[model samples]
Target: MRTIEEIKGRCFITEDGHWLWKGALRPDGRANIYAPDYTRWQGDMRTQCGTRAVWHCMHRKPVPEGYRVFGTCTEKACCNPAHVRCASEEDFGLWMRKNGNYKGKTNRILANRAIGRKRSVFTQESIAYIQTSDKTGRALARELGVSEASVSKARRGDIVVFAGAAGGMFSGLIQRGAA
Candidate 1:
């Protein structure tokens, strides 16, 4: 295992306080470190990843089981302890969702569903007919940019706000007895 002294000698601190490796870098732009004595570390097999090695060298402790170090700064090669957190991948995903870091397209759609931020693809007249129209759920969903389940829920009256447009007047169907 390379001693903390050796690792520190190969790295420099950034203006932001990150310990960046000056050695070889991986294709992903992450630091790469390898040592002949690395096998001596029972704690994560003396990681070849520069960031992980930096954490181990600084903390002088093994990473807790069921957790991996994540870069809070979004830098894969950042070795600053302050920028790293130890958490299960699942927990990290939950944190991402809560912290608005979950920007995946599907997740964005889910966020839209939760907050009613999804734009209404149906007009007032379209909403009025969603319930009585003989169109299939798939067609309605595609036309409305919603899931087939949403179309079904709207038809069942489970979604009172069936759509949003021209103000919150989506429930206009109820006033007109369109249901």
Candidate 2:
């Protein structure tokens, strides 16, 4: 059986250009199983960030010792040796929760998919209306039914806020007032 040291070579990129870390090795000199949905989360894994770190699900497991891991959130391929740590099953969960990178998923899934609860149902337009009209992202988020950060993103142009302002409305209003 091949060991992780042998798997240290690079893996092929997917059609979308995402890199996979296929070089994981087991402690007993066996080739670690590699899957397409592999997760590489970065953090201090040794302390069990909070809850039971061991995910008993069939899909996930703890990373092997001495292997460089990265945060799926940053998407940075950096393998800084100092960033690595050995985590207990519980510590890993705490780190994921406190850092808001729970389960190696991006913020989009946590918010849109509602890993814990129901998702917000506001569109960009709703956020823009709240921001411009109410002049408060927090309040607008409340009124628009989304996160304050989402409202801020809409204002900052991170997300497309459809333009609904019309010059005709101003002109018509001016004409009516004059009459």
Candidate 3:
């Protein structure tokens, strides 16, 4: 088991009182630590976030159940106990909503549409046409200005919006589970 002093030694305190971790970082750029005996049941090393490990070492207790530890400072790699805080999922969500940083479903959809990342080329009329038209998938796709896969899906009633359109060509097949 590594001592607290050894773990503390791996961090360099900044003038702003941030303990910048000089250890491995997770893919999200957060600090990670490999503790050999963090859990006794496994008797093996475990990778833990640096801030959580530092909070455990300083407080001599694990973070409260149903709570997650996060850094409060601007430095993503800081592991200072004073800069770490624990919050339940609900509390964190409330805080995010209060700060207007919560990206809920409506917000995500709006953002995606604003960036032109999610625009539906298939409208109700196009879907109806795709279902009724006897043209090949490629031809239908070319006529509709969409991909062949999209045309195929529309023909097979796989597209959600157009699948239930009344009097569509594939409506009978869709009802019979044949499409």
Off by over 4 Å in 1: 35-47, 59-62, 98-179
Summing lDDT over every window of 10 consecutive residues in candidate 2, give the lowest-scoring window.
48-57
Candidate 1, pairs of clashing residues: 1-37, 1-38
Q: Write the per-residue lDDT of candidate 1 for residues 63-82, one digit (tens) a residue.
A: 66676766677666665656
- Evaluate residue 76 in candidate 1 and report its C-alpha lDDT on the 0 to 100 scale: 65
Candidate 1 vs candidate 3, lDDT winner: 3
Candidate 3, superposed: residue stretches over 4 Å from native: 1-4, 36-45, 98-179
**Candidate numbers, best lDDT first, in rank order:** 3, 1, 2
| C-alpha root-mean-square deviation, each candidate | 11.0, 15.0, 13.3
Error of 2 at 1 (Å): 14
Better of 2 and 3 by TM-score: 3
lDDT of 1 at 91: 91
Q: What order do you get sorting by TM-score, best first? A: 3, 1, 2
- Which of the numbered candidates is closest to the native, going by highest TM-score? 3
Task: Quote the lDDT for 60 in model 2.
Answer: 42
lDDT of 2 by residue, 1-179 (tens): 12222222443344544333344434532223332222344422232211112121122454554432333223232112223344655666677678876555655543443422223344455644654684677777776677888777777655532223222323324533532
Q: How accurate locally is residue 108 in candidate 3, as Cα lDDT from 0 to 100?
A: 58
lDDT values for all models: 0.65, 0.40, 0.69
